[model samples]
Target: MDDFLERTRQALAAQPFTQLLGATLERMDGEGVALALPLRDELKQQNGFAHGGVLSYLADNALTIAGAMGLGRAVLTSEFKINYLRPAVGATLVARATVIHAGRRQAVCRCDVFARDGHGEKIVATAQGTIAKVDELPAG
Candidate 1:
C-alpha cells in the first residue's frame, strides 16, 4: 500500500494540467480517494462560479485514482457522466471518489464534489466513471 501511494503521488505530480489546477490527493485507501483543488480566477466561468469543466475534470481524476488504487494498476477513463448540483462559489473544492465495482477489465466509480463556502460545504457536482485497467503501462 505504501508503494502504491508513492507511485500515485509521483504520477499525479507529473501531470502538467493537474499541477496547473493545484489538485492534490488528500487521502487514498481501499474505501476511497479524496482530492482538493483551490478556487482560482483561471478556473472560474463567466458567472464567477467554478467552471463545469473544472469540476468534471477534478471528479474524473478523482474517480480514476480511486479505481486504480482498488485495482493496483494503471487505469484510464473510458466513460464518464457528470451532474451539476449547484453553483460552485467558494475558496476551494473537494472531490471524494469511491469504487462501486471492479471487474477484470473495467471498474466503476463515483465521485462527489463539494464547495466550501463561508456558511458551510455544499454539493457542487456528482460524477460516475468507467475506468479501463491497462496491464502494459509502466508503474510509477
Candidate 2:
C-alpha cells in the first residue's frame, strides 16, 4: 500500500492541473481509488456552485487511476461521459472510482462524486470511462 501510494503521488505530481485544482489522492488499491478536493472560492462558478469542469476533472483522474490499477501501467482516458445530478454545494468534494472490466489494453471504469451535505454526503455527479493502458505518459 505504501509503495502504491508513493507511485500514485509521483504520477499526480506530473499533473500540474490536478495540483492547481487542489485535489489529493486519498486512497488507491486494486479495487478502486478515492480523491478529494476542497470547495474553494476559486473553484466556484458565478452562481457559487462548484464548477462543472472541476467535477469532470475529479471523475477523470479517479477513473484513470482505477483503470491503471487493473492494467498495472499508466492509463489514458479514451472517452468518458459524466452526468451532473445536482449542484455541488459543500465544504469538500470526493470522488470514488472502480474498474468494472479490464483487458490487455483497455479498461472500463466508473466514478461517483459526492459533496458534504451537512448530514453526510450527497451525490453530485457520476461518470463512466474507457481508459487505455500506456507504456508512458506523453511529454509535456
- Over 13-60, each residue of candidate 1 has an lDDT whose tens digit, in order, gives 999989999999888877799999999999999999999999998999
Candidate 1 at residue 19, lDDT? 96
- Model 2 RMSD vs true structure: 1.3
Clashes of each: 0, 0
Model 2: lDDT to the true structure: 0.91
Q: TM-score for each prediction?
A: 0.93, 0.94
TM-score of 2: 0.94
Cα shift from native, residue 38, model 1 (Å): 0.5
How much lDDT does candidate 1 score? 0.90
